[model samples]
Target: MGVSDTNYQIVYRGHHLEYFHPGGWVFFQRPKEAGGGFWLGRTYDFVFMIELPRPVSLREGILYLQQLKYESAS
Candidate 1:
């Protein structure tokens, strides 16, 4: 899990959905073994009650969170 002034991020080392940030956004990140990558849109018409993913690794998840902040800032 990660927290910053702009947003919060949680990385699941395992496969399971146990948390979410209401009114926020949800994204899916494919594992590296399965072509790992992720892209998050700037805005959404609706809120996502669940944000879950089985990232390739914890590093990938941290990278995703970093991008999340950068992308959303723009």
Candidate 2:
């Protein structure tokens, strides 16, 4: 297994879900495929959390996360 995954238990990978930070942040590792993301397949650059300024509904929060992921990747 990868070093970053040594002590980490990943529930999913493809959907930008990897590990969780203590501060309620989730990380999504960029894939090694072409045009992956900001991390560009580098395991270390896999920070995928964005803190929203205001409180949002659970559905909105998920949308924000997805937006952040795409923004960061582009």
Candidate 3:
């Protein structure tokens, strides 16, 4: 499956969030909203989680991860 079709597991506040596809080669802010935290990860078998001043949207995070997968695949 392509990066766009990959599924992700997102946990927020001890709750499970829906899986979303992060685009390729994109930067994603973290936490969900503003003033939460930031996270970074590769589509491969590794993910780097970071804390941000604000919670970013899930779309961005997912897209960024997908990009990583694409890059590694290349």
Candidate 4:
């Protein structure tokens, strides 16, 4: 699937975290200080959801969410 740049930009970023809300889905990433690296994940209902591999960086999370946005469109 092809994703438009304007459509998938992250909606928010702060405190070492990033957020993207594309349609009903909510995607976010946060640092895992204890174990190191970061946590990247997404949800539709905000309760049940999916996660990218752990031990990732904040940049990786953003890309993952962007990809999710594109894939979800399909």
Q: Which has the better lDDT: candidate 3, or candidate 4?
A: 4
User: What shift in Å separates residue 43 of candidate 1 from its native position after superposition?
Assistant: 13
Better of 2 and 4 by lDDT: 4
Candidate 1 per-residue lDDT over residues 1-74, each given as its tens digit: 43344444433334532455554433344456776554232223444433333333445545666886789999
lDDT of 4: 0.46
lDDT of 4 by residue, 21-48 (tens): 5343333333344555544444333452
- Flag clash pairs in model 1: none
For 1-74, candidate 2 gives per-residue lDDT tens digits of 12263332222236544444443433233345643322211123434334443434444545655676789999
How good is model 4 by TM-score? 0.40
Report the Cα RMSD per candidate: 6.7, 13.4, 7.8, 6.7
State the lDDT of candidate 3 residue by residue for 5-24, as single tens digits. Answer: 34445445434333434431
Question: What's the C-alpha lDDT at position 6 in model 3?
Answer: 45
Off by over 4 Å in 3: 1-7, 14-55
List the candidates' TM-scores in order: 0.34, 0.34, 0.40, 0.40
